[model samples]
Target: MTTQQDPSRETVDRWAFADTVESGSPARKPGVRLGPAIGAAAAAALVVVAATVIPQIRKDPLGAARGTVPQTPTGAPAAQAPAGQAPVGQESLAPQQTPQGGGGSLTYANHAIVGPGGACCSTSGGAWTAAGTGGYPAYTGPVRTSADRNAWYEWNLGRPASGARWDQIKIRLWIPQAQAGAWVRITVTSTAGSASNVATFDVAEQEYQGWYELPATFTIGTPDRRTGSAWVKLTYLRPYTDQAAAQACADGSCDRMAAAQAEFLWS
Candidate 1:
């Protein structure tokens, strides 16, 4: 499920100061000048013009012109529309133990993005560790991001763990109630090597009410099976996005705990 907090409805209307005409007030009649009579008439005409235009200018107390208002990133009024896509309002999808079509082995892994000195940019969750063979690097609890949007918590399913003949699979997740939209992304990959085969999906924010329980599934089609890679990777794209989104609902520390508990199950 995705969420959105509409600022217009939420934001308090600000008070505006009324404007005064810069030119002299019309109450001051044409001054008696040392010059000719024509000069006096010209001064009177100027006052008439100011009187006409100043009233129109004062009509727009906020300084905005007719038919114009500040807009959002996408050409629509920022006050009325959300940035990028429209806000998601539905509940999170429910968890399902059984895969859509059924029958497959499943494994789970956890990762966080806290880097050197613990900046905590995108990382979430508690400590994580793995045990396996075939030089498959078990994804340690917190993965690091280098601006590539490509940090992953990897898992392996070689001969012993996964039968070589099984050609189809599905992946699911336990998304936190708080990070419904702002900062979370989901991605899947077919290789542990540098040039990994991959797929990605974006999660959006949801409305405020109750926590969301979403279960997402993806099919490993025939083509992916033909490639012959022995490992799979699940990544939390832009974990910071998740942090920010979830923070909207809860405190930063609370949000981190929520994200850490997020589960990734495959079948």
Candidate 2:
């Protein structure tokens, strides 16, 4: 025979039966925690967010902070100036670039077509004259009447390719009936800049008459810079004779040098 159950106890028994039915699986233990499942879901969300954010940081590190974006200009010309011109100078106006190639070219902001400097001779047409004979329009490679009688010829070699290097220079000069050899200096320099690459040639062979290429090729330019302005100086290492006096005569005037062209070579 069954005993009659209390009403409050019967109520508690019914609630426990409901919880077991909701869980459904008999293998599921009671009082298991939901906190681990919630934590795992949050960690997965953080990984997804990081994947999207890292690329943005790399695309532009300062874009977010600077509030400005950098973009490559569209439809810009490959070269600013025409094929045979250089940009306006940060200093003076550079001359037009020579259109021809094969390495012999001059491009400068402002340049002097080589002329004779210092007092030593007379110039007429394309030759320097001293004594009774005339030499090619050239500076008198003095024989040394004094310390200041050296001859210097200068020309403005245009600026080099923005980053291009000044490799070596090939120069052509003439020496007429010489009693002895003199010292010739090829100096690649910048205006108001110290001497860059300087190469010297000794013309000892009196047989080296007429236009002869300097047997010694000069490698020019300062370190990583262009040979700003190019100048050539001729001084006597061995005393032979000075001709400037014969050309200067009673007047201190002289003629122009039209033959001296110092070339710039680039890689």
Candidate 3:
């Protein structure tokens, strides 16, 4: 029992502006802060003292009950690691978990820019296309303009080849070096209505330049909404030009907008 509060933890938190603390419960420690939730009275109860020091803080001169500690090399509040303290901040980050064969996952054959065909650029209309380019085993197309039809596809997740519905459709894709910073929208249409999920890549993240399952598991349609509908169609919206597709062949940095080995994920 000491009269002094921890110098580092003696902070007046402003209405719980405390996102910096990591997960896992922090136990009551002498210097460690229990946070603002604990009122001043509760916090005051957590002090420790050397054997010779008096338990009463008022009786002790200066609140040095914890003893004279060395100053931090910098004046900033530094993290003090007490003996056997497990390191903080082991966050359970968003998962890009690989789909194992049996875990609520189903396979849906991709309709747009299917893979393992090899890299080549073509044009169906004003929209530029890359069926198989660079042997990357995925689609990589960048929009030559902000047009709606530049890079687009409509694939149906037909009434469950295996069952009536599934957890979600898993689309496997790879973001190549050239495909960095590409924006795309995925829209799913079913009996109820259409829902659109959009995402963009600014850097080569976890699955960048390599085959990776899209971070999100998408719903073709909900059970009620899916009843009358025959199947769910997923459309990719991106704009590109034929000229741009040819240019991509010349340039090594190609923006891949295609996916490979699409499947329905089941529970």
> Which candidate comes out best when scored by TM-score?
3
Report the candidate with higher lDDT, 1 versus 3. 3
> Per-residue alpha-carbon lDDT of model 1 for 1-267, expressed as tens digits?
232211123644444445667986668668665568888988899999999878878988654577787665697775533454433432233344773443333432222222222332324232432212211022222222222233343333222233222243444333334322233444445442233444555554233212223333333333213233323233433333444455454543221221222222232
Which regions of candidate 2 deviate over 4 angstroms?
A: 1-113, 116-133, 137-166, 178-195, 216-227, 240-267
lDDT of 2 by residue, 85-202 (tens): 5443322345558844443333322222222332322222222333322234453433211123344444344444453334444455545434223333333332324544444554
- List the global CA lDDT of all models: 0.37, 0.39, 0.38
Q: Supply the global lDDT for candidate 2.
A: 0.39
Q: What is the lDDT of residue 197 in candidate 1?
A: 49
Give per-residue CA lDDT, model 3, range 96-166, as digits (tens).
57944432324443333332332322222234334334224443433222123354433343444334233
Cα displacement (Å) at residue 13, model 2: 96
TM-score of each: 0.27, 0.30, 0.31
Best of the two (1, 2) by lDDT = 2
